[model samples]
Target: MAQTKNLEVWLRGPLPDMPPLLQPIAHALLQAREEVQSFMQDFPEELIWERPAGVASVGYHLQHLAGILDRLFTYARGEALTDEQLASLYAEGKPVEAADQVSALMQQYEQRVDRALEQLRQTDENTLTETRRVGRAQVESTVHGLLFHAAEHTMRHVGQLLVTARILREKTQA
Candidate 1:
């Protein structure tokens, strides 16, 4: 029932444990999370993996959202992806026999966001400009760049999920 009509996450006020400089990053992420969660509240389970217009499924979006956040946060910490993390990346979007329901996926996303926020809180604003490498490609980026990308990437996928879910819902109703 929470609507993002008049208010945004930033307008909601400052987040506890978040650095002033990183406030915008946290706001954008929390806003995307809220909108995704609200829009998915009544989404049909049967359509979780349905792909309309040949787009990626709702399940994929949910999983990718959580996975990407974790990976980006890891890079921000200056750590390479562990073997487990690599395996997770490979398994994303692949169907699972006992795949989690939308609620479970949402729970996982919430926990990951909590972890990301904690990391943000502990981040040193002075180091925001320090260079960081991403993945095996060693793509160069700054601490601030990675953090900003996390929020930006999340919002992008949230938009995708919203469109895909709406399409599936329309199909079901028709």
Candidate 2:
């Protein structure tokens, strides 16, 4: 009896404008973005930067999520990080005291995710295997690798951010 092999691994498709090979990457990035938005609804802004038990703060995760996508996509394009990007990386973990900082960070994260999706849409599947250099050290990786890592890393940080936000909210009420 011929049976269909595990279909879940090959089911990437249907995301508007995403390349056939890049659909999974786009889907993953969008899923991560939705998770962040869902978990952060009405999250108290005052605790965005409050690290619980020496872990990273929610604010740091938010900033790094955006910055990671931007940097990795830039690498995928075979370009060096610009001076502004370098400065953004330098600022990732620094806390801000501004009242609207959480909203600002959320906006930045969402914008980065949108940009990543657009890049995925425009990518040619033929170039997925082409080598790309990462960072000034010229670390070698393929276009596919960089795009996959961008989605993976964004979800990783979103998980951490959600945990941190929950902990901060719980602590505030205790």
Model 1 residue 155 CA deviation in Å: 0.2
Over the stretch 1-174, how does candidate 1's per-residue lDDT look in tens digits?
556467888887788878999999989888888899888998888888888878999889988888889999999999999998898789877755555588777877788888888889999999999999998889999999999999899999999999999889888999
TM-score, cand. 2 vs. native: 0.90
Assess the local accuracy of residue 37 in candidate 2 as a C-alpha lDDT between 0 and 100. 89
lDDT of residue 67 for candidate 1: 89
Q: After superposition, how far is residue 89 of candidate 2 from its true place, in Å?
A: 0.2
Worst lDDT window (10 residues) for model 1? 92-101
Error of 1 at 151 (Å): 0.5
lDDT of each: 0.88, 0.87
Those runs of model 2 whose alpha carbons end farther than 4 Å from true positions after fitting are 1-13, 96-98
Q: How far is candidate 2 from the true structure (C-alpha RMSD, Å)?
A: 4.9
Indicate which candidate wins on TM-score.
Answer: 1
RMSD of 1: 2.7
**What's model 1's lDDT at 59?**
86
Q: Clash totals for all models, in order?
A: 0, 0
